[model samples]
Target: MPITRRSAMTLPSLLAAPALAQPTRPIRMLMGFPPGGPTDFVGRLTANGLQDQIGQTIVFENRPGANSVLAAEAVARAAADGHTLLFASNSLAMNASAYARLPYDPTTSFAPIAMVATSPNVLWCGTSQPWHSLDQLVAAAKAQPGTLGYASTGNGGNGHFGGETLRQALGIDISHIPYRGTAPALLDVIAGRVPLMMQTMVGAIGPYRENQLRPLVVFGPNRAPELPDVPTLKELGHEVPDSGVWFGVLAPAGTPPPFVMRVSHALQAMLEKPESRAQLASQASVPAYLGPDDFAARIRTDVTNWADVARRAGIRPE
Candidate 1:
C-alpha cells in the first residue's frame, strides 16, 4: 500500500470542496443607534439568530450619530462580500428626505437582505402634563398654538416626523424640540420640559410602566397589548399615517446576488423560529419578515412617502 507523492496529491484534490462550499468569514453588523435603545435590542436578537443560522461569527458594532447616516455610509463603502451589514431602520428612510445629500444613497448604496421586525410609535406625554387623551392634547395645542412644544430624539427622526404627521393630520401648531437622543428627550418630557412626544412603543414602554410618561394613543393599526386602554389614531377619528419604525438587514450594493440570496434565506429561516419570534415580541417588536425584493420595495416606498411628509411639513435639511 505504498503511495507515491503524486498519488497523495491526487487524494487531497479529490477530497477538496468547491469555493462556494467553503466557510464564510465572520460578519460585522453595524447599528446606527447607541446601545440600550430599541434598535439595539432588536439588532442583537437578529445578529444572534443570524449567527446561529449561518454558523458564522457576527459582530455588532454601534456607530451612533446623525441618525445612522454615519453607519449607513460605512456599510455602503465596505466590501460587498456579504460580510458587512447595516442594521437599518425607518430612520434611514427619513434621512433620505431629511438630508439634502448623504455620503451614500439609501436606495442604491446597499442590497436589501430582509425585513426583520417593526414597532408602532406611541403618542406619549409627561405624566404631570394636563392632557390625558389625544383629543385633550389637540385642544390644548389649538388653544396655545405656538406655545406648545414637543421633543424628539433628533431632527428629521421618526419621532420628529411622527409628531409632524400627527400635527398635519389634525391641523395643530406645535414647535419641535430636537434632542441628541431618546434619553434626554424622555427626561425632558418626564420633567415637564416638553409637553408631548411621539416615540417608539418599545422605548416608551419602560417609562409608561414606571408612570413617568402617559400613553395617549397608539399610532399603529391595532392597539398595543402593553397599553390596551389606549386607542389607535384611526379609532380616535383621525386617519393614521403609514409610519413606524422597522428593522432590516442590508449589505453594500454590488454584493453578489447569490450571496444576498443566501443571507436572505438564512434570515427568513431565523425569523420563522418560535424562539426568535418570542424574543422579538418580548422587545415590543412585531415579526415582519420580507424577502429581498419586497424589503427593497418597502424601503423605497418609505423614502418617497417620508419625502412628501417632510416637504409638506416644511422640514428642510439640517
Candidate 2:
C-alpha cells in the first residue's frame, strides 16, 4: 500500500517494541548538510540544548552529500539503538520525489521522533530588480512567461516546491535554477543573474539586512516574527499550505520507543526555556514542538504534499 497521509507511519507500532538498554557512551546524531550552514547551526544548537535534558553527551557528525541522503542512509542502516539518530530536515520528505530512488524508504525506514522547529521561506530578489513586491514580480513573469527563473539550493527542495506552488497559483511558467548549495544559488540571485529565490528566514536574515536581497513575501502560514514588515502569501489570500523548512529527529525503524520518548521529552522541555527560544530566534526560527505521534502525522502530511509538488513540477534528480 502507498504511504498516504493516513498510513505513512504509526507511533503505536514503534512503541510496541521491546525496551532496550540505553547507551552509556555518547549519542551520535548525523546531518547531511556541510558545516557552517543554517541547518548545521540549528542542529548543533538544538542538540546542545537537548543534551542538558538527556544528561548524555550528543556528538554531531556531518555526512554532507546528495542533500542528506548519504547520512540518512547511514542512520537507516545503523543499529536500532536510540543512540544513533538522524537530525533531518524537510528534505527527508521532499527526497521521496526528488530522487528516483533512495537507499532507505523515508516513510518506513525511520521512526519519527520529534519535530523541533520550523521557519518560513522568504521569497526574495536582488536589489536591482524592478519589482518591489510579489504581485509586481508575478506581473513581470506573466508578461514574460518562461523567461523568469527562480534559484533554489537544490532540486526537490523547499525552494523548488515553493516556487512551483507559486507558479501553479498564478498559472505562470517560471524556470527553476538549481545550485549545488545555498551559497552559490544565493550568490547568483544577488548578482541579478537570477531574479528570484526562496530562502529560509535564517539564511536570508544576514543578506536581507545588508540589503543584498529584498524580501517580497513569506511563504509560511503566518508572517515571520523576524520579518514582520514582509507580508505572508496567506495574507494575500494565495490559499497555499505552509511550505516552510522544518528540522526534526528520526531513528532507525525499530529503535525502542521509550528511548525515543526520552529524547522527544527532552526536546519539548528545551522549548520551555526562554534561552532556547531566544537562541532559536537568532536562527530565524520558532519552536513548533510535536511529540512522536504528532510528528509522525506531520511527516505523513509533508510526504503527501511534497510528492504532489514533485509530480506537478515534474521534478527529477540529475
Candidate 3:
C-alpha cells in the first residue's frame, strides 16, 4: 500500500512511539551535483537531520552528470527497499522536456517523500549595462532585439528555462549564451562578456553583494530576503512561470508505505527545527515543505510546464 497524505501527515505522532523499526542497512542519499554545490549542501543537511532521527548512518552519494539525469535514473532503478533515496531538484523536471527520452519517468519513476527547500532564480545585469530594472531591460531588448544576450548553466537548465520564459512572455528577442556551468556563466556576466543572466540566488548572491552584478528581479512569489529591494517577475507585470529551483527527497517507486512514511516523518520534524531552517538559509534556500502528495503534484506540474516551454521554445536534447 502506498502512503497517502492523511497517514503521512501523522508521521510526527507515529515517531513518538517507542517501538519503531529502524533501517538495518545504511541509508544512501544520492544527488546529481558534486559536493560544494547548493544541492549537495541541502542534501547533506537533510541527510544529517534524518540520520539523527532514524538512528542510522546516511551516506551522501554524488553522481554528477547530465544535470542529475544519471543520479535520478540510478535511484529510479535502485532497490525499492527505502534504503536508497534521491535528492531531486528542478533539473529532473527540466530534463523531462529537455531530453527526448529519459531512462525513467520524472513524474512516476520515484515516490516523493517531501520537498526540502526552494531557491528563486535572480535576473541580473552587468554593471556595464545601463538597464537598472527589469522594465528597462525589456525596453532595451525590444529596442535592439537579439542584441542583448543572457547566459545560463547550459541548454534546458533552470537558468535557460527562466531566460526562455522571460523572452516569450515579454515578446523580446535576446540571444542565449549557454555555458558549461553557472560559475563560468556568472564570471562572463561579471566580466561584461555577457550582459545578463537568469541565475540561482545561491550562485549569484556573492557577486551581487560584491558589487559585481546587479539583480533586477527574482522568479518567485516574493522578493528574496537577500535582495529585498528587488522585485519579482510578477510584480514587474509579467506572467512568467515559477521556474525557481526546488530540492526534494524521493524513494524508489515500490518502496513500502510504512518505510516511506518513516523517512517523511523524520524530514517533516527536521524541517520544523530552527537550526534546520538556518542551515537552509546558509545555502540560500528556504524551507518549502510539501508532503508526498503535494510534492508529487509539484513534480507533475513542473514536468508539464517545462515540457510545454521546451516544445514552444524548440529546445531539443543535446
Candidate 4:
C-alpha cells in the first residue's frame, strides 16, 4: 500500500517485527549526484547512523544523470523488498515538473521512509553588486528588468525553482543561467558573471564565511542558526513556497509496511541523537524528521507546489 498520512506508526523497536528477516546483503541506497559533494556528505552521515541501528551495511552508489531522474527511475524499478532505496533531495519533487514524462510517479512510485534534514537556500551575490539586501536587489531588478540574471545548478534544480518563485512573487525579470554543477555556478556568481544565485546553505556557507559571497535572504521555514542575521522569505513578508533542499530516504513501492517502518524508526532514532544533530549542524542542515506518512505527504505537496509554480511561471518541462 502507498504510504499515506493515515498509515499507522509506532516507536522503533529492534524486534518489533521479527517475522521479516533483515537482508543478508548490504542495502543499496542510490542517489543521482556523485560522491564528494554536499549530498554525499549528508548520505555518509546518515549511513554511519543507520548502519549501527539497522545492523546492516548500506552502500550509496552514484547514478548521476539528468538531474537524478536516472537514479529515481532505477529505484522505482528495483525490487520492492526494502533492500534498495532512494536517498533523495527536494529535487525529487521538482523532477516531476522539470521533465515532460517520468517513468515513475514521484510520490507513488516509492514509499517514503523519513526526512533526515533540510538545508535552506540563500540568495548570494558578489560584494561588488550594488544591492546589499534582497529588497535592494528586487528594486534594482524591477528597474532594469531583464538586465539581471541568476545562476543555478541546473534548469530543474532547487535554485531554478527558487529564482523563478522569487521573480514571480516580487515581479522581477531576472534570467536563469543553469550550470552542470554548483562549483562552476558558484564561481560565476563570485566572478560577477551572474548577479545573484540561490544556493544551498551547505554549498554556500564556505564562500559566505570567507567573505567571497554575500547572503541577502534565506529561503527556509525559519532562520538558520548559522545565519541568524539573515532574514528568511517569511520574515521578509513574502510567502514563498517550501523549495529548500531536504534529504530523505524512500523504499520502492510494494515494500511491506514492516520493512518500511523498520527504516523509518531507524531514521528517527538516528536524528534523535545529539551527535547526529551536531553532524547535521556542521553541514548547515537541521534535523527535520517526518515518518513514512508525513514524508509521503510532504513529497506529494512539494510535487504539487512545484508544478503549480512551473505552470504559473510558464516553465516548460525539459
Q: Which ten residues in a row have the lowest lDDT in candidate 3?
A: 14-23
Off by over 4 Å in 2: 1-21
What lDDT score is found at residue 11 in candidate 1? Answer: 34
Residue-level lDDT tens digits of model 2 in 1-318: 122343224423332334463566899999999999999988998889878766678999999999899999999999998779999998898888888889998888999988889989878999999988888998898899899999988788888889888888778889988888888888999999999997888888778878899989999788999777889888888877567899999999998777887677667767778898898898788888887888888888888988887777777655
Name model 4 segments beyond 4 Å from true: 1-12
Over 4 Å off in model 1, which ranges?
Answer: 1-23
lDDT of 1: 0.83
Deviation in Å, model 2, residue 300 alpha carbon: 1.1
Estimate the TM-score of every prediction. Answer: 0.90, 0.91, 0.94, 0.94
lDDT by residue for model 4 (1-318), tens: 123333334443442556563675889999888888888889888877888778789987889888888999999999887689889998899999999999899988998989999999888898778888888898898889899999999888889999988888788899999899999998988988788898999888788888889989988679878888989988878998977889999888988887887878778788878899898898888888898899999999999999999999888998
In the range 173-281, model 3's lDDT, one tens digit per residue, is 9988999987898888999989999888877767877899998889978789888888888887887778889999998898877777677778877887889989888
The top-ranked prediction according to TM-score is 4
Q: After superposition, how far is residue 246 of candidate 1 from its true place, in Å?
A: 0.5
Q: For candidate 2, give the lDDT of residue 10.
A: 42
Each model's lDDT comes to: 0.83, 0.84, 0.85, 0.86
Task: List model 1 lDDT by residue over 24-96, tens digit each.
Answer: 7878999988898899999999999988866679999999888899999999999887679999998888898
Error of 4 at 165 (Å): 0.7
- What lDDT does model 3 reach? 0.85
Error of model 3, residue 63, in angstroms: 0.6
